[model samples]
Every structure is written in C-alpha cells, then in structure tokens.
Target chain A: MEPPRALLFDVFGTCVDWRSSIIREGEALGRRLGLGTVDWAAVADAWRALYQPQMETVRSGARPWVTLDVLHREALDRVLADAGLQGVPESDRADFTLAWHRLDPWPDTVAGLHRLGQRFVVAPNSNGHIALMVNLSKRAGLRWDAILGAELARAYKPQPEVYLRGVEALGLVPSQVMMVAAHNVDLVAAAACGLRTAFVPRPTEHGAGQTTDLRPARPVDVVATDLGDLAGQLGA
Target chain B: MEPPRALLFDVFGTCVDWRSSIIREGEALGRRLGLGTVDWAAVADAWRALYQPQMETVRSGARPWVTLDVLHREALDRVLADAGLQGVPESDRADFTLAWHRLDPWPDTVAGLHRLGQRFVVAPNSNGHIALMVNLSKRAGLRWDAILGAELARAYKPQPEVYLRGVEALGLVPSQVMMVAAHNVDLVAAAACGLRTAFVPRPTEHGAGQTTDLRPARPVDVVATDLGDLAGQLGA
Candidate 1:
C-alpha cells in the first residue's frame, strides 16, 4: 500500500498514558490540599468513564456545540460528586480539571512521533479543543503540523465529519491520510470514513487488567505493539 | 510590562519573503514551460496586489467564506490574464497557486521562532488556511503551536473576528496575546480589538522601492527591526 501523506492521531490514550498522569496529578493535588489517602486511581478511571457519555450529548445533536473543555469540566463535576469529593474548592477543582492538558507521553511517543513527523504530516485528531491540544503538546513535547479534530469540526469522534473534516483540512483525500489510534472503534469509524488506519495498542491505557482495545478487534492496515514499533513498521 | 502568553504572526511579509520566493518559483515554472524573458517579479507583485480586493469581497459579506487557496487561484487567473499568460495550463496554474505554501522564511524566521516558542505559544494569524499554514510551516521549518487564522474564523485579517477568534483559540484574553505583523493595518486592527501589538518592519517586503509599512504607523507595544530583534526584545 502507498504510504499515507499525513497521520491524524487519537491522542488521549494512543499518545499519552492519561490514567497514570491524571492519577499522579490528583495525588499531588491531594497532597497539597492535605486530603489524606484519596483514591486518585479510582477517581481517574471514573473521570475517564464519563468521557463517552459526555461527548455523546454533542454527537447526538441533543446539545449545541461546546468545546471539550466544557464537557471535561461538566464531567469533572459529576465525577467529583460521585467520588464524594464535592467539597473540593472551586479554584482547585478548576485547576485540577486542566490535568487533561498536562498528560505525560508514553515512553516511546515523543521519539516515535518525531520520527513519524519527518516522513508524514502529523496532527491530533482528538476530541480535545485546540487550546487543550496545544497545552498537551507543549507539556509532552509532542509536535504536530496542525491540530485537526473535534473542535475544528464542532463534533466528536466516531462521527463521520470528524474524520472527513480532518482529512480535508490537510488538503488531502481520505486515503492519503492515516488515523492512528489505540482504540479499535476509532479506527473502525475512521475506516468507514475512508481513511487508512493504524493501531498501536496501549494495553494498559485503562490501567492493569484493561480488557478493551488490547488488540485490534478487526483487521486494520497496520498494527504494532506501540508507537515506536508502528513508526519502524511504517519505515519512519 | 507584562509579557504576552502567545504570539500571533502575519505570515506573508512578516515571516516569509513572499515576493522573491514567488518570483523564483514563477521563473522556474517559466523555464520548464519555455516561457522566456517573463517579468516574474511584476507577476508576483500583481498577484499580491489582488489579495486585499479579493478578500474584501468576503469581508464585506459580498461573498460567502472561502479559503485563501480559492482567493489565490481566482487572483492568479486575473493576474495571468493581465500578464498575458492566460494560456497557462489549468494544471500548471493550479500547481503554481501553491507557491504561497512554499515561501522561504526571512533569514531570522526559523531561529527567532524557535527561541520565541520556548517562552510563549507561537502561531500564525494570517489569512492563510490551515493547510497552507501547515505546508508553509513545514517547508520553512517554522514550528507553530497551532494554526489560528482566517479559516478558523471564516474571515480574513483586519476582520474583527479573525483576531478575536485566534485569541480565543489559544485560550488567551486579547491582552495576553500579541499580534505581530509587518503591516501597520493588521496590527491596528488587532489593537482595536484589545490585543497587544508588535511591529517588525519588513522594509524590502515589496522589493527595494517599497515605501509602505517601513515603520509602525502608531505606538505599539514593541517595535523591532526583524524577527531576531523582536525575539530579543520579547526576552525569548
């Protein structure tokens, strides 16, 4: 197959270990607030669990377009209340919500992206807004040629427009762009929109014993153990 | 003075030498097409001279929003007719329109941007679309945190929404973002919208006889000779 001209990434899990990063940030915030023995890992998982349902509100056209930042904040409020931390101060809670923008890259993410970027135009096809993507890239040293995703399309992932709009934004046809993700469903959505697909499994994205997306559920154009392996496979 | 959190640049004359680059590309195309002794610089100047009028049609609501690519192509057709080169093939004309995406950066552009990016978010707030901005950045090795400009707002520079939307995209208040440009009018429009402004004069932007925008028309937050000087003044 001809190599893709550009690669659009599903950032949250594919490029970053959000669970560990969120938990770590939460623990630090907990220490600063002297909230002893908070279960940040559970909190992290709970917060992440709300992502799909939150975005579905927009995807389903039940609500007007709102940025991922708004969705994240709304979800944080629900997650905090569910975890019995509703007493968290407004300022601290707001600050903590930005943990999503401070996620650390997976071990091989930076180097592999740098390599892949040399051969292809790379950008995040994330649900995150431009500001969130910019901050996350700055924090993780993840360079992108552009930030093309939900915010640009004003719609969430798995929606056909999200994939198609990103392809068009790069002045490329769907087949000339590859969607790189850890989530099989995202690849399936992208493929349905006519983009090439690559799966780089992040087995522990949901922490140990994670069952979902540990492997590609269906055949994709490329699949590898991680970003570095994927980069090598693509001759980057 | 408080430093700005992000810098939004006007790409055409501020960061890249569009005149010489377009001329060079035109001459090379002329050579390949066996069109000898063509005054490429005149053609380049004529093409650029049409930019504002073309965009004005959109800004005045006389036309619906379209990318700079469309405007450039439309202007290129007029320019070729005016220059007596209307016989150029459609394929060649389409390829030639992308010359905007391959402009060479000013001597200090890449290094200055590298240094400035270390301290503040750097992005293009030009009228160019994301694909144009991305291709230009990649070709010039001019890195950007995001591509925020005309296409994002569906409006061209000097339009209030263009500056406002770029500031919003970076999650920055207008005062916290600096609009850097070689054109006095661009900075004036940005300043009118409450953004900080910087002037870096490109004295030869229109070639040796260029008389406009050789200096800032009014007081701005900072005035520098070029990108390197601007970087140093901004403490980047």
Candidate 2:
C-alpha cells in the first residue's frame, strides 16, 4: 500500500483519553463547588453518550450552527440535570465545559505524533472547532501542522465533507491522506470517502470494556495497537 | 500594556529571508538547465516586484480568486518573459515555483517563536494558502499552533476579513490578538480591524538598500528589532 502523505486524526478517544479526563475534571469541579460525592464518572459517560444526538441536530438541519464548545455546554447542562446535580454555579459550569479543551494525551500520543510528523503532514480531523483544537493542543502539547475538522467543514464527521475538507486543507487528494482513529466506524466513513484508514484500538477509551470499536469492523488500510504502533507501521 | 492572547505573523520577509533563498533556488534551477550565470538576484527581485499587482487583480475582482501558489506561477511566467529568460522547461519552472515552500527562516525565527509559543498562540497571517504554509512550516521547523490566513479567509491580506478571520480562528477578540509584522503597512490594516500591532522592521528584506517598510510607517503598539526582541518586549 502507498504511504499516506497527510494523516488526519480523530481527537477525543484516539489522541486523548477523553472519558478519564472528563471524569477527572468533573471530580475537580465537584470538589471546587463543594458538591460532595457526585457521580462524576457517570456524568462523564452520559455526556459522551449525548455527543452524537446533539450533533445530529446540527447535521440534520434541525438546529442552526454552533461550535463544538457550545454543543458541549448544552450537553453538560443536560447531563448535570439528569444526574440531579442542581444549582451548579454558572461560572463553574462554564469552567467544567472547558474541560474538553484540557483532555490529557495518551502516553504514546505526543512522541508518536512527533515521529509521524517528521514524514506525513499531520492535523486533527476532529469534531473540534479550530479555536478549541488550538487551545486543546496547547494544553496537551499535541503539536499539529494545522487545526481542521467540523469548524472547517461546518459539518460533523461521518459526513463526507469533514473527511474531504481535512484532505483539502493538506492540499492532497483523499487517496494521498489517511484518517487515523480509535473508532472503526470513523475509519468506515473515511474509507467511503477514498481516504486511507488507520485504526488504533483504545479498548479502555470509555473506562475499560468499551464494547464498540474493539476491532476493525470493516476493512481498513492499516490497523495497529495504538498511535505509536501505527507510527512504527508507517515507518515514521 | 496588556499582552495579547495570540500573535499573528507576516511570513515572507518577516519570518524568512525570501530574497536570498529565491535567488539561490533560481541559481540552482539555472545551473540545472545548463543556463548557468543567469542573473538570479534580478530574477528574484523582479519576481518579488510582481507580488502586489498580482494580488491586486484578485482583490480588485478583475480576476477570479486563486491560491497564492497559482498567482506565484503566473508571476513567475511574466518575470521570466520580461527577463528574456523564456522557454524554461515546465517541470523546472514548476519546481522553481515551489522554492517558496523551502525558504529558510531568519536566524532568530525558530527560537523566538518557541519562546513566544510558551506564552501565546502564534500562527502566520500571510497570504500563503494552507499547503504552502504547511510545507513551509515543516521545512523551516516553525512550530505554529494553527495555520490561518488567506486560504482560511478566502481572501488576501489588507482585506478586512483576512485579519478578522485570523483572530476568529484563535477564538480571540481582535483586541486580544496582536499582528506582528515586519512591514508597518500590514500592521495598519490589522489595526484598522481593531487588532493590536507590533512592528519589527526588516531593513534588508529586499536585499540591502531596500527602501520600503524600513520603519514603522504609522503608529503601532510595539516595535522591536526582530522576533526575539518582540518576544522579549511581550515578556514571552
């Protein structure tokens, strides 16, 4: 197989452990607000669950455009109410919403990406808007050649344009670019758009025993254990 | 004065020594074509001279929008004919055009940007499109937080949207972003859009004895010798 010229990444579960980071940030927010003994992990999981449905509103044209940060804020409000964690201060709620921007990288992410960047042009094909991506990269030390994804496409992933715009930003054809993600479904969507695909399994992406995306559910160009392994496979 | 959240750069002469690099690349192309001893410096100067008028056509709507790469190619064709250096091979001309992507950074660029990145998000606000910016950053070892500018705005600089879109990409208010440019005229446009401005004059940008942009042509928020000096003044 021909090596891809640019590698577009799925940020949340693939590059960073979003579930764990969200739970940690939720716990910290709980501590700071003196809201003792809340179910932070459950809240995190609920919030993650809401990701698609909220985005679907925008995708289906039921709602007007809003940045991912805005969507996360709305989801956070619903999650907090569902968890019966009432009276969360507005400023505290806002701070908690920004936790998404502070997600921690998986152990091998930084080194592996720097290695891959030496060869393939690398950028995030995330649900993240450019500002969110920039702030997240700064906080997490995930160096990127550019920030692209939902914001650039004005549409979410699994939509063809997201994958296409990611390739366009790199000034390469879809065949010349690869989409790397922890989710097999993302790879499926990318493959449909003619992008090369790399699947890196993060079995514990949702606090272990994550049933979905345990393996490549469909054909992919490359499959590796994690980003570092993928980088090794790519000869980066 | 309050330091800005992001620093947007003017790339060509400000960050990289385009004149010498273009001359060198031209010389190499001339030698490879068995047309040695061609006046490379003159060619470089003539090429640089066409920059503004070429962009002005697009800005004036006399021509449809094209990426800077396309504009550069057209300018190259004209400069070659004007210099009586016609009949260059297509592949060689194409390769020579890509010399823009391989331009070398000034001595203090990388280090100064690294220092600046420690405190603020830094990205180019040049007219170069995404691919050109990406290749140039990779080649020059520039660690930009995100790529932004002409392509993002779909318009060239001195256009209000170009400066506005750059600030928007960082999720920053215009007041919270500073335009750091070697040319004061660039700062003037940026400042008109309510962005803070910093001036770092490159007296030798157009080869020694260059007359234009030799000083801050108008009032600016800060003035420094080079990027390092600017970073120092910003306390980065």
Model 1 lDDT per residue over A23-91, tens place: 999999888988888899999988888889988988888998888778878988998898888888999
- Checking candidate 2 for backbone clashes, the offending pairs are none
**lDDT, candidate 1, B147-195, per-residue tens:** 9998889998899999999898888899999999999999999999999
In model 1, the Cα lDDT at residue B51 comes to 92
Per-residue lDDT over B58-111 for candidate 2, one digit per residue giving the tens place of the 0 to 100 score: 888898778878988999999999988898989988889899999999999999
Model 2 misplaced regions, further than 4 Å: none
The candidate that wins on DockQ is 2
Tell me the spans in candidate 1 whose CA falls farther than 4 Å from its real position: none
Candidate 1, what DockQ? 0.83
Q: Quick one: best TM-score, which candidate?
A: 1
